[model samples]
Target chain A: MSSKAAQKQAAPDSPQRVLTGRQFMLGDHACAEGALAAGLDFFAGYPITPSTEVAEHLASRLPAVGGRFVQMEDELGSIAAIIGASAAGARSFTATSGPGFSLMMENIGLAAMMELPCVIVNVQRASPSTGLPTMVGQSDILQARWGSHGDYGIVAYCPSSPQECFELTIDAFNTADRYRIPVFILMDEVVGHMAERVEIPEAKDIPHVPRKGPRTAPGTGQFLPYAADADLVPPIAHAGDGYKVHMTGLTHDERGYPSLTAETHDKLVHRLVDKVRLNAADIVDFEEQDVDDADCVIVAYGCTARSATAAVTQARAEGLRCGLLRPKTIWPFPEARVRRLLEIGKVKRFIVPEINLGQMRREIERLTQLPTLRLNHAGGAMPTPNAILEIIRS
Target chain B: MSTPQPNDFSVVHPIDHLMRADRLPHILCAGCGIGTVIHAYVRAIDESGTDPDQHVCVSGIGCSGRAAGYVNVDSYHSTHGRALPFALGIAVHNPSLTVTVISGDGDLMAIGGNHFIHAARRNVNLNVICINNFNYGMTGGQVGPTTPIGAKGTTAPQGSIEHPFNLPYLAKACGASFVARWTILHVRQFTDAILRSMDKDGFCFTEVLSPCPTSFGRRNKLGEGLDEVEMYRERCHIENGAENLQDLDIDIVDHEQPITVGNFVDIERTAFHA
Candidate 1:
């Protein structure tokens, strides 16, 4: 079948090849398949609630495929080891939940500063501190953005179903490679545990972006490990490759040598922030349904977005002009598109429903500044479609 | 015009090739034992016969942390006390590379204490060298994890009531395959211990007692850098293969007992990746 036909059929079959056949699997298991499909061979993680299966599955499957799975002493080591592996020229990743994510904050910052390409999955649980281990919450949205101290940018994708979990994970790896930053896949408890049928496309058909290293051999040209080449990002050279590169968390020049001057600090930090900020248009992605000609627009993501779909469908049938907007990528917040929606004046207001106490709602309100009502909950349970529909009617 | 002949000083130095020439005149204080340890480390690398290209050095934040930056190899200047975990990552990924972590006592035992014990317990195939100066020398001599009880520091102006860690004891108890302790004065012994541990297949640890003249030494009346080294020569004793690392704590307050120094533990264990 042609490429267009494969997409048009929306069936499990594709023309070129079928990577993995359709199967009934849990969201966590599908996540492992996505990693395997993306050439992931190194997994270092500490198991936590709603996310342990992802690690458990990879632990057994990775070795057969010539990959390595290491259950580190703790979350800190998990993040550290993967960063080390990534620096050593291997595609690596790790998965964790609430407390584990918190423990990974410092090293996550190190990953960002070193410009290492790696992926982290936050199967979020409710928290102020380990609130509900087995339940879902999207409270980590802001934490995912600014959790690490210092000025830098990160890319995050939120998936609502097991299928999206499989697809977005591959994209997460590609994006991490393209930008040389730590990419996050923020999955809550429900989506991580829920079982569904997922069709993985053929490996060749899936997109892959490998980390770019120096084209010039080490010592031939003046190679600056941190030097940006037009894209505001530098190519990474692995150790033992004779690059003889030195990586440090401190502010440094492109030569990867520590330069503690104020001028050098300004130049390095601005580039780190701009690499993501300027490329926001390319990184932002979302799904909009019946958005135009609607009086009320409901913005949701992850597990809550799935429920919002039903609520919006019922509202439309009841003769209410309501639509649903689900974000596929949440970190480089789809600001331009959402701002355009608010500008057109078709939608009167927006309702933001989340498992947590209105975390992303604040960002939506901040961006649009329109009449935004927050449908909030403290988490352990998903908000019912009826509860959301009642808000749309009011 | 012809290039001038290389200086005699550079030719005789054991670590001249290992040093990052551009980064010479390191940031170490004149009497600081860090440079001495670096000399000993490079000598060990040469003696062990490991290719310098195949070795990676990782260090945490402190005066000692600067050691990684000055080494002519793939090195990582990790965040405070995070050298061990980061080095473990590099070692486990590339088993062909010999990974070493060099950091200070405050860095390895205080902020990074959990990682220290856990890395040993797991018995990862990495060599760790800790420079114990008894206080946080880089941050104006604050009290730290290895600060002896009733010792004076900026943070412990009233005299620290906290007891310091017996690092060799800690490493042995935490399951290190090889453990040893030596002062800066015992350069040959320290270098030999590092060379010996290089062949070990599991976690290996060595603690070097170095002087911090500017911060730790001045306040404690240990004299200048040379005075501190002289004190070590007088107070230190060798007790190789001695059991019970627990009783080997440095007693600064009483000043009566000799400071024990030597290889304390050497036993084989299964490596983590193996």
Candidate 2:
């Protein structure tokens, strides 16, 4: 019954599609390659600076592998298309920048509410409104966490280098599938544009996570599309799979019907949030360096983490007790690790350096309630190692 | 409440197999035409002889958007003004599924207008059923892009001075492979139109001119739902293959003006791909 187009399954990672070897590649290109490796079946995107390469590269690469890529009318359509594809049981995604990211927020919330699995790559540029479209910014850190209007939990990853961009994008798709929610690769313009070594492993070696499907057989007349098990995640039934699943953006019950009661809303929303919140230990990932005995911890992510790592090294050479803590998963913000660092009573202060004025620093301050200083940059440029060192010295 | 025994309900609805009968007592008000349109849609699905499991219905937010929920298919009720792109995603990803987008006028031609034209222009293979009740019925009959000029709405209490779109012409101009319009009163034709659209390969559109008696009808002095159907019977004329689609604009304010309804455009076009 499948149409000719539908019969063309996303080709297994071929040598032509997957550049399986160590090679210098742009962060955006590496992100696309990573999606290809992760068995991406569909991608919809709009052209925005720092993120356009991700789309442009995928446009050519996806077709080669029999996967589909669509340049949608706008960011709104791009995100909407990916959500639809995801609901249809395709491993789908979309890439955008700050302004486009803002346009995608409403649909992102829908994906969260519907518990659809899709990846979103926000190659963030400086912005409130089209600020430094071609330059770097980490200001969207908070936006990634709170841009979509709602209380649902989301997963976001901040990759500091091209290699991490490739690696974390796969993780983003896996996490999205695991939780049946939208996962974000919150990349900055520097990381998106910078060229660095990306080690692409063989397709078999790359870890991939397929979507969970209902154990209930088709035509059983017993499948409840939104009935979650102990993990609070319902197995998704793809459209046209004879499951007759009805999914909606409205608050729904276990049957996926619009149950607009306060009780159903409360239960549905709490499950949406708890799925990730309870699994925070497994979802949250970070790298801590030289923090066994340090008085100051420099917390950072994305491109700024590179500068923080340099600053930590310089502080150590200069006989100062400073360390670096970089969060790979930004949302589910490594609170436990930061709290543990604080409880040890060794880390007295935190200095967060980023391209943004102060986004992640606010999280650190809010969580630890300690003296936290920010090495601020209003984007278009990254803070130098010396600038971060000055904050650590202070 | 106790579950009724099988013997207690001897008579089953003819289209019950294709409907979420459990979700009945639908949200539609008395005299609304959305129910009729959904009926024709489900009837067409039954007559199509295709696997019911291979059908997917998607709807954006509005009165007509509820069609997705009521349809006993793998369906999705997406956000407002996004059903076209969402359906496009499904259609493009898995063309095996006969995806249909059922939405209201404001949901399709207003906020979702961009997606509508682009999807048509790309010739995406999906069926679109746009229920045009002249105003935003769910939002208390506010003025919308399809509300005829000089028509009264909640937002335009005096009259809607803005121009409304001629939906059939818009769809045709946007390169739809098949374009048709029918009032809900034309139940048989409407069902056949939907069935015909399901057979087309590229983008196909069927605009359903429905009545929102509670919200739009009362405000515009269009009387009850039956009165609106009577009006359609009086004014509507089937004109298939009519030339100069530009003249097919609907004028509710002037009862003397004719409402042209027919399968206006049907031609082969290459469906969009990656």
Give the best candidate by TM-score: 2
lDDT of 1 by residue, A1-394 (tens): 2232233232222232234778788888888888878878578999799899999998877755656788877888888888887877767899998799988999888998999888999998888697999988888998999999998889999999999999999999999999999999999999999999998876677788878888778755366788788889898888777777899998988878888999998888888888999999988889987888888999999999988999999999999999988999998988898888877988789999998888889888889767898888887888889999999999
Instruction: List TM-scores for all candidates, in order.
Output: 0.93, 0.98
RMSD of every candidate to native, in Å, equals: 6.1, 2.4
Chain A of candidate 1 gets a TM-score of 0.94
lDDT of 1 at A164: 91
User: Which one is best on lDDT?
Assistant: 2
Return the TM-score for candidate 2, rounded to 2 decimals: 0.98
* Model 1: CA > 4 A from native: A1-19, A219-221, B1-14
Give model 1's DockQ, 2 decimals.
0.34
Error of 2 at A99 (Å): 0.6
